[model samples]
Target: MPQDTIPNPILRGFNPDPSIVRVGDDYYIATSTFEWFPGVQIHQSRDLVNWRLLTRPLTRPSQLNMLGAPDGCGVWAPCLTHANDRFWLIYTDVKRYGRTTVGGASGASLRDFHNYLVTADAIEGPWSDPVHLNSSGFDPSLFHDDDGRKWLLNQLWDHRPGRNRFAGIVAQQYDPAAQALVGERRNIFPGTALGLTEAPHLYKRDGWYHLITAEGGTGFGHAVTMARSRTLEGPYEPHPDGPVLTARDRPHAALQRAGHADLVETPDGRTWMAYLCGRPLPNRGRCVLGRETAIQPMAWGEDGWLRTRDGSGDPELAPPSPGLQPAPWPAGLEWEDFDGLDLPIDFQWLRSPFPDELFSLVARPGWLRLFGRESIGSTFRQALVARRQQAFCYSARTVMDFAPAHFQQAAGLVCYYGASKFHYLFVSRDDEHGRHLRVMSALPDSPQADAFTAPIPLPDDGLVHLRVEVDYERLRFAFSLDGEAWTWLPEMFDASILSDEATAPGAPAFTGAFVGMACQDTSGTGLPADFDGFGYVERAYAAKVG
Candidate 1:
C-alpha cells in the first residue's frame, strides 16, 4: 500500500533557520529572530511535523536590548544541544548597523558582535543569564567532538593584512565548564573561492568533521556548502563539485535562496535537514514571511557523502521520505484566549533585551498585557507581540478595544519587523473621537515616517473585527463591525520589504520572512489595550499560494 501523503510545507509562515536536536523520543528546535525580543525561541516536537514553543532562551535585561530596534540585528541563527544532562544554546547577538557604539555611546548604540551562552536543566527554563563569549563575529555555533571536546564555530570579518573582506569562518576550543575560549582560534574556511560565506554550522558524523556554511550571500543567490575533514584540526576538503545545496542553477525553483541548515536524524533513523528559504512574489523580491523554515530529506550517496534528495539543494515542498506517515496538524493557541502560565512556543516576540518585565504572560486574567514604555521608537519597542509564521497565506483577526487615557496609548494588531519596518491595523480612541481604526507603516532607518491614517467607523455595538489577508505578494486588509459584511480597505501596501535580500543582505541569512499578526497597546499612558477573540487561519485562500 502507498504511504499517506501530506502537503508540502509541513510547517509554514515565518519559522526559519530551524536548528533541531533529538533527546530520546522528543525533538527540540530553535530559530533566528532578527531584532525581535526574547531573542532565541525554543520549540518542542513529539513528531518532527508538530511543534510547540518551549521557552525563550534569553529572558534577562542584561541578555537582550529591548528599547532599540536592531536592524538585521538581534538574534541570528542559534544552535541547540543537549549534553551532560543539560541543554546548552550558543547564539549571536547582532548589533544593528548604526546602533553600535565606537567608545561609550548610549541609547540604541551599536556594540561589537558577541556570542552568548545560556543553559537550563529543563527545556522549559529558568534559563541562566547569557554568558558573553567572543566580542566579535556572528552566527556562532557550538559543537561537541567525539572526544568530549567543545568547539565554537563562527563567521567573522576577514580583516587580515590587506584583504578588506567581510566574511570568514573560524573555530576554537570552548570550555563550556569555564564558559570561555580555551585555545587559539583557527581560520578554518573563508568565503568561497569565488564568493562570500556566513552562518557556518559544524557537525561530526561517520568520522568526518563537517563544516557546513552558507554562501553566495543571503539574497536570491544564497546557498549551503560543505567541507569535511577526518580530524577536527586538519585541513578540510570542500565538496568536489561545490555547494551541496543551492537554488542558483534552478532560478525558477518554487522555494528560492535556500541555505543556513542544521541536520538531524529522526528516532526512526531517517536523516532530515531544516533550513531557511523564501518564496518571492511575481515582479517583487520582498518576503512578507521573511526567510522561513523548510525541511528536506538527506541520504548518503554511493560515495558516503551527504546530499539533498532533490539534488538542487533547495528546500523541497514535499516530505523528506516517501513512506513516512504524515502527522496530524498541530493546534495553535489563540492569542485572545491565551491564559496559560507560560507563553506558547509558537508565539515569538521582537528583539527585547529585557523580556521578563517587558511583558507578562499572566499579568491579568485572560489577557496578555503589555505596558507601554518610551524606550524604543513609540510603543513598537516595548510591545509584547507573539507571532507564528509557519504558513504562506493566512488571516489574522483580532478584536482590540482600548480606551487610551493619553495620546500615546495606541493599541491594535501589527506586522512588525524592527522599529523601522512594520505595518499596523489597529483602533485607538482620541480625547475628541471615541474610537477609530487606523493603519500605520514604518520602514527601517526611518522613524515613524510614511504613516497614512484612515479612521475605521464602527457601529454602536462596540465590536469590530480587523483582518489582514496575505495572498503571496499582495496583502489585502478588511474591517467589519460584524463578522459578515466585510468592507475592504482601499489602501494596499506592497510588502516586499521583508525579504532577507531587501532586509539583511550579505549573509545567506534565513530569509523566512515572517507574516505574523501581533497585538500591542503602545499608548504610554500605562493603560493596556483589552484584546479578545483572536483567531488565525492558515492558508485561508488557496489562490496564489506561496
Candidate 2:
C-alpha cells in the first residue's frame, strides 16, 4: 500500500453514515450531523479522491429545529439521490431515543422522531421545504423503480414491550404527482437474521431489487448485510455468504465498526461503496475521531452478490484508486481570522442560531463578537461557534479581549464533545480573584462537575491568548499575556473524556468531538466577548494502518 493512499476514507472525522449518489461523472455524499445546526452535511467529488463540502440543506429552522435536542439526537443518516431531473434527499430528525429498562420502553415515548423529503434542481440551491413523511423509524432511503414508481424504505422500530428494537424493514409507495406517500407501508424484509439491523438502502440491478442494511448495532459488532427479491415488495432472501463487509470479526484490523454503506456505479460500469467506518487508536481502541467515510472497491459476483476487491468481504485500507488521475487535495486545516463578515462553512452552532443576537462581525470590525446567552451545559441557547474535531492530534488556539465584570461572565477556548462533557479555558473576573484566567473540566457522572483550577491572575491589559494541545492522550492548556511569552498550566487533563464512551450512558453522544471559542453570561448581563482570531492545526497522519 502507498504511504498516502487515496481510496480509503475519502472524508475524515465526524462524517458518518454516508449515502452516496453519482450524477454523470460527478458524485455526492451526505452524512449525519446529529444536534449540530446547518444539519445534514453534503460533500461533492469529481474524481472520488478529492471531496469538498458543498451545502447543508436543512439550514432553515422550519426544515430543522434542533433546539433542546439531546446529544446525538438531531439528524441521522441522510440518503441522496438524483432522479426526474432533480436531486432528492430523505432524512430523519431524531429528537429522542434509547431504551429505558428491560421491557423495551424507550425515551422516544414523546414521539419526537420525524422524516422529511426535500428536492433541488441543482446540487447547490434554494432547496424546497421539507415534505413530511412517516417517521415510523429512522435512516430512511428513497428508491425509484424502473416502472416510474417511487418507494421509501426504512427500519420499522418496535417500541412495544418484550420485542426487539428493530422490528423489520418496511416500504411505502410514494406518489410524485401528489408529493405524498399514498399506499400502505408494507413489511418487505424483516432482516438478514443479523439482529439490530438498520440503515436500509434499496437498489435494483439485473432485474433484482437489492436491499442493504447495517446490522449488529453501530458499535464494534456493526456490519453491512444484504438481501434480494424479484419484486419491489416481496419475500426477500438473505445472501448465503452473509455480510459482505465488516470489521467485527477482525479485531486486529486498523479500521473498526464498518457499516452503513451506499453504492454507486462509475461511468466505466465499476461499482464502489461509500460507508461509515472508524480508525481507533492503537491499544485502548477508543475512536477519538468518530465514524468517518471510507470507500471500498466492489464488484458484482456472477451470482449477483456484491463482493470486495479481494473477494474476502472485508474493507480495504488501500484499494485501487478507482482508476483516476489524482486531483489536488483541499486545504485540511481551518483558520478564522475574523476578517470576513460571513462565517466559514466549517463553523456551526448548537441549534437554530439567532445570528444577529448571538454573534456580531461589525461590532469589532475585524473580530467575532459573541454575546453570551446561556452556559455550555445548557441545551438551550448558547453563544458557541465550533468546528468538528477532525483529527486526534491537533491544536486550537484563539485570541480574545474579554473583561468579565462578575464571576458569571467568561469567554475562551473550548474542546466540546457534547453539551455536558467539555473542557473550557476562559478569563473571568470575581470580587475575590479580581481578574484571572482558569481551566475548567466537565465529565459525566462526576461528583465535581464543571471543576476548575484556581484563578491565575491575568495581566492588567484585557487581551489574552489561549491555546490547547490535544495529542489523543492528554490535553495541555497554555496562556500568553504577550503573544511571544507563554505560561503553561500546571495540570494536564485526560483527552479521552471528550469522546462518545465518556459521555453519560443515557445522553446521546453519537456525534464526534468539536473545538472552538465560546462566551456566556450566566449572570443575565448578555455581555459580549470579542475574539480577534481562531486557528486550528493538525499533524498529517494516515488514518489507515495496514
Candidate 3:
C-alpha cells in the first residue's frame, strides 16, 4: 500500500459514525454496525495513516441480541472514551424505526431506540454487560467533566405530529455510582437551519464546552455542525460560518456523505479528526460499500473555532499523516480454506449471536456447514455468513456442496444489502426443473419482485463452484462443475442497487453491501450445506492474491 492512500478511509467497508478517542499514544475509533451482529466495529491506530481492526466489544447474547432487529436498526452511533482508567462506551440499539412496524400493526408509528453503557478494562474484553440508559432518542455520548461530573448528551426525538422528528440535542447529568442519569434533561443545541440534528460529541476547550453534531441528515447533504457554550448548560452559539466540514457543494469529490465526525489531539498538541464518508459508484452514484471511516488534519483558528487543515471545509482524498510512526498491520489473506476451527476474524454472521444454530466449522471437519434455517429475506435467523464489500471492484468466489432434495431448500452465494434488496445465485431442486442453478434478485424499487432467471439444469453431484465479479456498477456471476472451467450467467445485474440510497424515501438504510455464503430451507427442515472454502480479491490489493 502506498502512503498516498493514507487519508482515504483509514477504516473501509461498512464502518460508519466514527467516535474516536485518544488514550496515551494509542487511538481507538468505534463505528456503528447496524444489523450486522457482533455489534460495534472498533479499530486502533498508532498513526492516523494506518488502522487495525481491534475488537467488537458487544459479543455475547446478553450484550447484544438482534435476533429480530430490523435492518439498519441494530447499533447506531457509539461514543468511546477513556476515563477513571477504564474505557467507557455508549451506544443505541434501535429495535424499530421508520414508518414500518415491527411485530406490531402495519403503519404503526412506534419506535424503540434504547441506549446503554458498558465499561471495559481493556479494548479487547471480557466486557461487562450493558447497563440500560434512557430511550428518549438515539446517538448518545457521555462527557466526563474536568471537575469529576459526568453528563450525557443525545438528540431528543419528537414524534408528535407537525413537529420535526429530529427535535434537538439534549444533555443531562449522569451519576456513575448509581449507574443512572440524574438532573433534568435540557435541550442544549436546537441546531442550525440545517435540520435533522443528531450524533452529538462534546469537548471542553479553553473556557468553553464545544458541541460537535451531525446535521442535514446522513445523506449527500450531510455535514458536521459545531457549537460552543461558556457553561455546561444554557445558550450555545453555532459557528459563524456554516458546517465545519462537508462535501455537499463538491458533488464530484472522491468522498461523499461526509459527516458524523469525532476529534482527538496528539501529545504534540496537534488535532486530527475521524469522520465517516462514502464513495458512490459512477453513473448510478450509489455507495454500495457503505459509509467508511476516514481521518483529516484539523487546526484551531485564532477565532477559537476548529477548521480543516487546508480550511477548504471539504474532505481531502489525500491527507497528511498524524506525525506518528506508522505501524501498519500485516495484510490479510485473500482465500480462506475453512480448515480452522473458528470463523475468520474478517468475517461476521448476521444476528442470532449464537453461531451454533446457523453455522459450524467443526460440523463437517474441514468445511463450513450451514444449517438451512429460513428464507434469506427473513428478519429472524438466516444461514448467512459474510464480510463487507470493501471495494467497488472485487470478486467473491465460493464452492458449495449441497443436495437440495426439495424445492424449498437452496444453498449458494449472495450479494446482500437488506431483506428486500439482494442478488442471490443458488442451487435448488424443483418439481419441474429438478436440480438446477438459478439467479434470483429482490430489487429495492420493486418490493414484490422475488424474480428468478431461467434455471440451468444440473447433475445430482451436488458439487458446484460459484463466483461473482463486481466492476463498478456491473455485477456478473459464473458457475463451474469443476473448479477449472467457468460459465457466465449471461446477465449483467446492477451492483449499484445494493446501497443505502436505493432504499425508499424515509426508510432506514444505514448498512453497506456484503458478499458471502448463505443457505435457506423454507420447508421447516434444517437441511445442511457444506462449503469447502471462500475467496475475496479486491482489485486494490489484487497483487497480494494472484
The candidate scoring highest on lDDT is 3
| lDDT against true structure, model 2 | 0.82
- Report the alpha-carbon TM-score of model 3 versus the true structure: 0.96
Candidate 1: C-alpha lDDT: 0.65
Runs with alpha carbons beyond 4 Å of true place in candidate 2: 1-7, 99-111, 329-334, 445-448, 540-546
Q: Per-prediction TM-score, please?
A: 0.84, 0.95, 0.96
**Ranking of all predicted structures according to TM-score, beginning with the best and ending with the worst:** 3, 2, 1
Best by TM-score: 3
Q: Taking the tens digit of each residue's C-alpha lDDT, what string does model 2 give over 1-546? A: 222456567778889999999998788999998878888899988777788888888878778887787767889999999999999999999867643444334423333568899999998878888999887988899999988999988888876656676888889999988989998889898886678888999999999999999998887888999999999897888988889899988976677889999999888889989889887766456776778899877988889888887777787777767656555556754578878888778888887645676788888888999998898767778888888887778877888988788889988999888766788998888888788999888877577767888899875556899888887757888898776777889887777777666656655656777888899999898999998888898865422111
| Consecutive 10-residue window with the lowest summed lDDT within model 1 | 99-108
Better of 1 and 2 by lDDT: 2
Across 216-322, the per-residue lDDT of candidate 1 in tens digits comes to 86667778888888877658888876877777768667777688788888866677777777766666755666676667678777675788775655567666343
In candidate 3, stretches whose alpha carbon ends up further than 4 angstroms from where it belongs are 1-5, 100-109, 446-448, 540-546
